[model samples]
Target: MAVPETNKVMRLLEGRHWELREGPFKRLGEGADQRLREIADNTSLTNYLRFRALIALSLYDNEETGVHLERHARSGIRPLPAEGFHP
Candidate 1:
């Protein structure tokens, strides 16, 4: 079973109240770029969350995010929430 924290995160990633997901990380600045990259690149994570990390990375000036975005864009991920999808 998924850990409680991870499970909650997965729930919030789905189409729901945006704040639960955004509020915590919205204030995060460039400092989070590296960690966000780690999350984006963590193959063990659900693709939905991985893509979410990429979305957050867009707020910063990290060039590496572009590469992740390109890879995800080509990954056939639809612009949908991270509920029952994986791409």
Candidate 2:
């Protein structure tokens, strides 16, 4: 599936207001390790913790900022403009 176009993903990676919960950073079956290594070799994510966190955020169920998003929407607050939509 196409990744959601939410800046919150990057924001979660950057350690901003939203925290990533129930991510997908566990064992990835057989050849998954090699795939991960290849990806790490090509990408900029240096630290394993950060990389795993990123994978968890992406490869798994993802974030839980519904309450936060609702608050922002209600109060007329917006994420960084780069995120596109306010929610």
Candidate 3:
């Protein structure tokens, strides 16, 4: 059977809440880029880091696509809630 993902991995996959406030694929820019660079130089860690980056990017990209679709589907609706507004 496949092993269940740990909370730490899930958290990384989900990313920080602050990133979500900005946009869907929030860390696709400088931060991930820099970390990947640092990891690339180390052969032992490069594979693990690259895998983590791929997982994070995939989750962020998938979420972003979903968000865009939701927005398009609701284009005629009233304005969305401001960032901090919950329900």
Give the whole-model CA lDDT for all candidates, comma-separated.
0.57, 0.36, 0.37
Models sorted by TM-score, best on top: 1, 2, 3
**Model 3, 20-87: lDDT tens per residue?**
23342343433442333233233453244433433344343345434544543476743323212231
- Model 2, 1-87: lDDT tens digits are 233323333333444343445342233333333333333233354344334333443443323323323434475533333333222
> Which ranges of candidate 1 are over 4 A from the true structure?
1-16, 19-30, 71-87
Indicate which candidate wins on TM-score: 1
Q: State which candidate, 2 or 3, has the greater lDDT.
A: 3
Please give the clash total of every predicted structure, in order: 0, 1, 0
Weakest lDDT window of 10 consecutive positions for candidate 3: 78-87
The candidate scoring highest on lDDT is 1
**Model 1 residue pairs with clashes:** none
**What's the TM-score of every candidate structure?**
0.48, 0.25, 0.24
- What does candidate 1's lDDT look like per residue over 1-87, in tens digits? 222243443444455333334555444423455667676667787766766766666665656767767776787655435445454
Winner by TM-score between candidate 3 and candidate 1:
1
**Best-to-worst lDDT order:** 1, 3, 2
Output the lDDT of residue 36, model 1: 70
